[model samples]
Target: MNVELRQVHDSDLPVFYRQMNDPESLRMAAFTPKEPADRDAFDAHWAKIRSSDAVVRTVLADGDVVGNAAVYGVPGEREVTYWVDRAYWGKGIATAALRALVTEVPERPLYARAASDNAGSLRVLEKCGFRTVATASGYANARGAEIEETVLLLEG
Candidate 1:
């Protein structure tokens, strides 16, 4: 599938909300908002990011909105994050989107974090040149418990 990233539009928020709330995706992502179904909070979060200095984009595959990708945080400490519809898993879309995003941002030493058990995400990050640098435990709202998380870095 042809994957591309574009500036996020207001219409894309609904699709992102849906993808973010998928139970399976949520569990795999682990560190998610405390209430994924709360549309108001979701909107608020998006509004905050959209107005920030972050680089956020809508992930389109074959011209359809399939997910989202972004880099956010203070300079030198910025991190990358992405979400792909479950239906498109294992298709290299996340890796492609992330690669494109990093290229666009032109920031080195981008960081990433994923649940230690989320092999798929870890693999995607690895394929995009992110190396595991540390591991830590955090409260996973999705899993409702403290879980191990992997920290990754993509350096210049």
Candidate 2:
């Protein structure tokens, strides 16, 4: 699979919403919005990000949208995040896409977080040179409970 990252287009929101709503994906991505099914909220959130200075991109695999990735937050403390279709999980898409994203935005150190149990995501970050700097707990909307999360940092 040829994984590539490109600017977020106007048409990608719906695909992102659907991918985010997948029951299995949500369970795996525990730290999600309060209401993943709220289209209004979803749209509003996307609008905000797309309009912000964030480096948001649509992850394309061989010309098809398979997921989304981005680096956002305040300078010097920005964070990285990505979501791949469940079907595409473990296919190296996330790792490739994230590597591309960091290459595009070389202003690290970039930070990332993943549910502690999400070994796949942690591995992706690690492969891209991110190191676990800390572990924290946060309320997970999808799981409806607080859970452990790992914090990682990538330094140039």
Candidate 3:
């Protein structure tokens, strides 16, 4: 599948919300659920991203939304996070999206975190030039348990 990263548009929220709330996607992402995300939440989320200087991109595969990837935080020091639809897992879309985000930002020392149990995510980070920097325990709402998170960093 051909994948490319582009700026997120308001029209993309429905697709974004669906992928984000998918059981498998949330499980891998370690997101803490408060309530079912509504259009308002999506609006606020996208608004924050749009108004911020951080680089946020949507991964489109064959004209369909496959994932969302972004670098956010203070300007020079940024954290990267991405979530791909469960159906698209293991298809190299995450790697491609990550590579594109990194290339676009070209900022030094990008940070990423993944649940230690998530080998696929860790592998993606490793493939994208991130080296494990630390590991810590945290609560994953998606997993509903305390889990170890491996922190990784990529330096320009």
Candidate 4:
């Protein structure tokens, strides 16, 4: 798949909304909104992020809107995040999309987090050059419990 990243388009919001609600994907992500079904809240959150200066983009695979990747938060504390459709899991789309996003932004010291148990996601982050910096436990809405989370960083 020709995975690439591009500015998030107005039409991509609906696609992202659907992808966010996938039960499997949510489970893998762990840290998610408590009310994933609340369209109003979802819209509000997206509106804020899209309106902000965050480096957000729609992930495309062979020209299809497959997911999203972004770098957000305070300048020195910025973090990198990405989601690949569950169907594309293990296909390297997430890794490619994240690398592309980092390249486009060209700002470093990026942070990332993943459910400690999500090997696929952790591997993707590691492959993208994010080193494990710490491990912490947090309430995971998707898991409905406090779980171990891995914190990673890519230094400039």
Ranking by TM-score: 1, 2, 4, 3
Question: Which of the two, 2 or 3, has more TM-score?
Answer: 2
What is the C-alpha lDDT profile of model 1 across 87-152, one tens digit per residue? 999999999999999999988879999999999999999999999999999999999999999999
lDDT of 3 by residue, 43-91 (tens): 7777988799878888998889888899999865689988888999999
Q: Report the alpha-carbon TM-score of model 4 versus the true structure.
A: 0.98
Q: What TM-score fits each model?
A: 0.99, 0.98, 0.92, 0.98
Error of 2 at 58 (Å): 0.3
TM-score of 2: 0.98
Clashing pairs in 4: none
Clashes in model 1: which pairs? none
Q: Model 4 Cα displacement at 131 (Å)?
A: 0.4
lDDT by residue (tens digit), candidate 2, 16-122: 99999999999999999999999999999999999999999999999999999999999999999999999999889999999999999999789999999999999
Stretches of candidate 4 off by over 4 Å are none
What's the CA error at residue 134 for candidate 3, in Å? 0.2
Query: What TM-score does prediction 3 earn?
Result: 0.92
Q: State the number of backbone clashes in model 3.
A: 0
Count of clashes, each model: 0, 0, 0, 0
lDDT of each: 0.97, 0.94, 0.85, 0.92
Local accuracy of candidate 4 as per-residue lDDT tens digits, 54-138: 9899999999999999999999889998988888888889999998888887787899999999999999999999999999999
| Model 2 segments more than 4 A misplaced | none
What value does the lDDT take at residue 137 in candidate 2? 98
